[model samples]
Target: MSVKPEPVSALFAGSFALATLSAPDGPQFPALVTPDARVTDLRVALADEALTVRGLLEDWAATLPRLRALAAEDGPRRPLAEFRVHAPVEPRQVFQSGANYRQHVIDLHVAHRAPDDDRPEEERRAEAAEIMDRRAAEDLPYVFIGLPSAITGPYDDVVLPAWAEKPDWELELAAVVGRPAYRVSVEEALEYVAGYTIANDLTDRATVFRRDMPQIGTDWLRSKNAPGFTPLGPWIVPAESIADPGDLRVTLKLNGETMQDESTKDMIFNVARMVSYASRTARLLPGDLVLTGSPAGNGMHWGRLLRDGDVMEGSVTGLGTQRTRCVAEDAS
Candidate 1:
């Protein structure tokens, strides 16, 4: 089987982003990624030989302007296509929003209706909509902690455990925190964001619910925290570049078939609310990710779950696109 690599620039527009990359013969390093697929190693650009994306994020206020200046000037650069891409940042914390998208939650409720449920589809949808409206009006966002170890490179392969009967795709928009935020207000939440990236939060439906201890709630640990479960970023597009994070399109395709394609407008709690809510209890540090939650059109909705050799391609408008092939791991 011959593999032809896709040009990294084709996945994004004419803008600048921060990414982690390595040449076929060199070590991985943070870089200034150009929409034309050229990369300027941040070490050389910043005059810091040991620079990392996390470190850049920690000093994002000072780093961003420098990155911008570098983006506009000529420097020693190599075609990004010649390098291996890695997850842009190795975050210390990951906060995941659950059922935050109105249509997404509604779709799940309707799709997972019990066998005894004989309600008309329209009635079920309407009921779900009402519940969503109530959830929207309510003050809090449903947020959960996720392990950073689960994160993988944007172009890496996802190993689906053989025991995972119903692995699914959930493409989401994740905000990258640049400033330390604690109990921040919704009006000021975006101020703490450095930028945004694409995240594909894969899940194992079979392991989601604990049949014996239903009261304990969804087992997110086993369902979502598997290694390589969260594929994040070819790069992080600066927040200043995106006009409105709330209006971007989140799209995912399976084997070239469009599966999840929804606007952030469908979100019950917007990015600000989600970020503010997350900061209320936990200290959101630099490089921490606040996943805004996945939109509708999961594998469960179409009854076509992930299989070995399936390819998932996802993107958040202007952020960039990520492609990952699925491989079934031997469970035994």
Candidate 2:
């Protein structure tokens, strides 16, 4: 049977669900959207082996409108609840910003100061503010690469490795690249964005710092790239749909208690700067994910790290909610 065609309204719509439908044939389609209002089933709006979803993202300006229009058409529909939601797109490159949130970095500086320094809280705040101002004025964004294998579905279960002692959650707003960006200016950065999504950048706090190699500092690979460490998606809201990425709120809850609640307005570099900074050194292709960093209120700040059977609910204003459960890795 042929997939149903999407409606024209879907093309102009600001939000759409690009999902993988579970079929006996296996996971099918990378760009399927719900054409009807009920979202019972998804229709194949765009499918190409070579370009994939990443290529479609390169021309998102044209592709999104087409997809939105397709979504308006009445074609084949599937039961939305029966299929599992994958990371909206399979990114060829993933760039995550580090210490890019104003309040978050400041909080770390204050909390991790030398015990003997004995600086007052006000002084620490002032110092941190000065440092941030200098970085913003002279320095570029700090970005690191992430393994795509670490990605999991929005509602997937996160397996806490037996070796990880302090699992933590970082709710962030992730931008989906729609066009090629290389050495682009900050003023033109947002033009490369296709849409936005939510990601929970789970971390193993205990492994963040290498005690043996203090000079080397952070060990992001070991601390942040475990399987199912990045829980992403639910939906990708078109960039046009988001009036202001900088103003959105990022909230996370541990189990049933609210843990992290902050706004993107606290970002030290903002999305445009982060994207432009990343493109300066690396060629950003369509479908590449650029995480804008998490705000303050991470588990490290609360001293309440994640444990087995813990649940994490992360949400961004326009993006969507992601619910993940933490389970202990099975010891063989």
Q: For all candidates, what are the clash counts?
A: 0, 15
Give lDDT for model 1. 0.90
The lDDT per prediction is 0.90, 0.78
The digit string of per-residue lDDT tens for model 1 on 81-183 reads 6888999999999999888889889988888899999999999999999999988997589999899999999989999987788999999999999999999
User: Given candidate 1, what's the lDDT at residue 181?
Assistant: 98
For each candidate in turn, the TM-score is 0.95, 0.88
Candidate 1's displacement at residue 241, Å, is 0.7
Best by lDDT: 1
In candidate 2, what are the lDDT values of residues 1-332, reduced to their tens digit?
11122223332234465553444555544555452323423233443444445556767777777777766666665655445556678888899988988888988888888979888999998999999989888888889999889998888788999989899898899998989899999999999988888988889988999989989999999999999899887666778878999999899988779988998998889999999999999999888999988888888788888888888888788665778888999766
* Candidate 2 lDDT score at position 262: 90
Which is the leading candidate under TM-score? 1
Which ten contiguous residues of candidate 2 have the minimum total lDDT? 1-10
